[model samples]
Target: MHVVVVTKNTPDTAATVTVKGDGTIDWGDSLVVNPWDEYAITEAVLLKEAHSGKATVLTVGTDEHQEALKHGLAIGCDQAIRVWDGALDGCDSLGYAEAVAAAIRKLGDVDLVIFGRELADIATDQHVYQVARKLGWTMLGYVAKIQALDVAARSITVNRLTEYGTQTVRSTLPAVISVVKDINEPKYPTFIGIRKAAKAEIPVWSAADLGLDAAALQPRTQQLRYQELPKREGTVEIIEGATAQEKAAKLIDRLIEEKVL
Candidate 1:
């Protein structure tokens, strides 16, 4: 299958992510793989098992992103690759699409590219469509299940979730697909796998390696500014009464006095 899955390191779902007073995001020390990408990695591994092919996971970021690649390696990906450059700072979805599309092209023989529905950190999924567009490949988003794969015919049939309902459609191979967590339960990395991934050497590709220049890394979309809203303050009151009826009466009276009744 030679499936290539994209993943990212993001704040842990349970972490309290907030914008600091300096305008930078504070994710604390807890970071993990994008929760949605778990299913994507699992799907890649499953595809490799079913088709006796390789599953390679790729990402774009700094050294901090290696954690995500290691997780993919532990999850059964045959290889892990990362791309980044100083110039890529402040890069938006369009710039990422440029880098990712170029990297995929450099690989030359990727049959399928998969992704999580969205990135947890960015809370946006535009890169998925942008990457597909840059590659001029068919994009199947919100895939619930991969129904069939015909390597001989170079076709794939998948059941994808639509706003209307689940719809099954077939498309040619060498395409892009975005999956949801419901597609499959991701397997936890085993002790052996974790140790191996910890030792695995992941190659980092630079913008030049992907034939990208500083101009390409420039963000097409800009975020002018953002400010956190002040926290609203409130107080809690305990209503006390000797009986339920008394309590109800008091609650009603309070509500009427507060003009909320």
Candidate 2:
């Protein structure tokens, strides 16, 4: 089985996000793997070991994306692919899905593809579906547990967590799965693994390398503006009455008048 895990470079959740007056973000060189992708990485590593398969990390970004790729390698991925196409700038979810799907197709004979339930930066949670659509593969999303995966049989079964309840899904191999954070606990890379990953040669690719059309990579959406959230203000008031009944009556009236009842 060959497993591919998709990851993305994003600001550390702990990092302070600041928007400049000119509407540009000041990242200040702090970057890390999207927190949610950690689950996908862990799942890929576990699945690879269980099935004696190969696991690879795939990412799309600039030079700063190396950190995220290395982190995945340190965790247990066999190799990494970084797509740094200049034409991918400002690429939205659809564009990203296109590039990643193209790369996967280039890899050839892949059995499984994994992704985080959502990207932390955008939080749109659309990459998995988009990539699956592009590849014409079965996509199981919000997977909380991979109950079964049979590479030889070319089949898989998983329990997905939905808003209403958990749903069990069965699909064939060559599928795309988006795992939620509850799927598994991510393991921290050991010192030895970290050192090895740091030295690993992560090949970078461009749109041409993936046989992708630059025109198709153009983003469909545009940002209109960026505005800081307004600061919250608080005020406190105590309901007053001489007696319990009086207080109750006053509170009822106030709630009724405010339409909060």
Candidate 3:
């Protein structure tokens, strides 16, 4: 039983965002693991603990990505792999998925691949499906609960939350799944884990190592513009009346006067 958790490095939620002259986001020094991916890591850790296996954390980024891998190690991942290639810088979602899927294939004998529903920076929410397609594996998205996993049968059953209702899905091993935060609570790093993570030697793999072509890694999408939205302005008005019924009437009148009703 081997589980691989895919994660991303993202700017802290509270960090101020600005755009560079190139129309690319200038994320400040504050960075952390994608918050949603933490849930996937938690679920993978729990699965490994219950079934006796190893959880490997995988990420695609520059040296800064090592921080996310270290955090994954501190949270209980057995191994961490950093996929970095100069050709991958600013790669589109399709190219990223291709590289990630290639890396996963390089790590043979992997039973499960877990990921967050989306990355905070891009928020396209398309990488998981693209990875699954590239890998030719079953893709389960929006997974809320993992009901059962039969190692011998090499199958897993989960409850997926949908707009209509929860749908039970079962898939065989070597599948890719994206989990929601509702699936599990991520654990905080302990002192011992932190010490181990600090001393851990995470291996970095490049596109060539994964048999990826530099030409294929070029980004298909381009950013036309990046600008911070203007702050919103609003005016508040108070309704006054002698009685509650009168106040209700005044509110209705005001609403109709403003054509808001």
Candidate 3: count the clashes: 0
Clashes of each: 0, 0, 0
> Which regions in candidate 1 have their CA more than 4 angstroms from the true location?
224-226, 229-261
Better of 2 and 3 by TM-score: 3
* Candidate 1: tens digits of C-alpha lDDT, residues 1-261: 689999989988887666777777666868799999999999999999899999999998988889989999997999999998887889999899999999999999899999999998779999999999999999999999999988778999999999999999999988999999779989889999999999999999998888897887788788764467777777767889999999999999999999998
Candidate 3 lDDT (Cα, 0 to 1): 0.90
Q: For residues 10-115, what per-residue lDDT tens digits would candidate 3 score against the true structure? A: 8898788887877778778888889898898888899999989999999988898888898889989999999988889889888899988998999998889999
Candidate 2 Cα misplacement greater than 4 A, ranges: 236-258
List residue ranges in candidate 3 displaced over 4 A.
19-24, 238-261
Candidate 1 colliding pairs: none
Question: Residue 90 CA error for candidate 3 (Å)?
Answer: 2.0
Local accuracy by lDDT, each model: 0.91, 0.90, 0.90
CA RMSD, predictions in order:
3.4, 2.9, 2.1
Per-residue alpha-carbon lDDT of candidate 2 for residues 35-126, written as tens digits (9 for 90 to 100): 98999999999999999999999998888888888999999999999997779998988899999999999999799999988888767787
What TM-score does structure 1 among the candidates reach? 0.87
- Model 2 is weakest, by summed lDDT over 10 consecutive residues, at 230-239
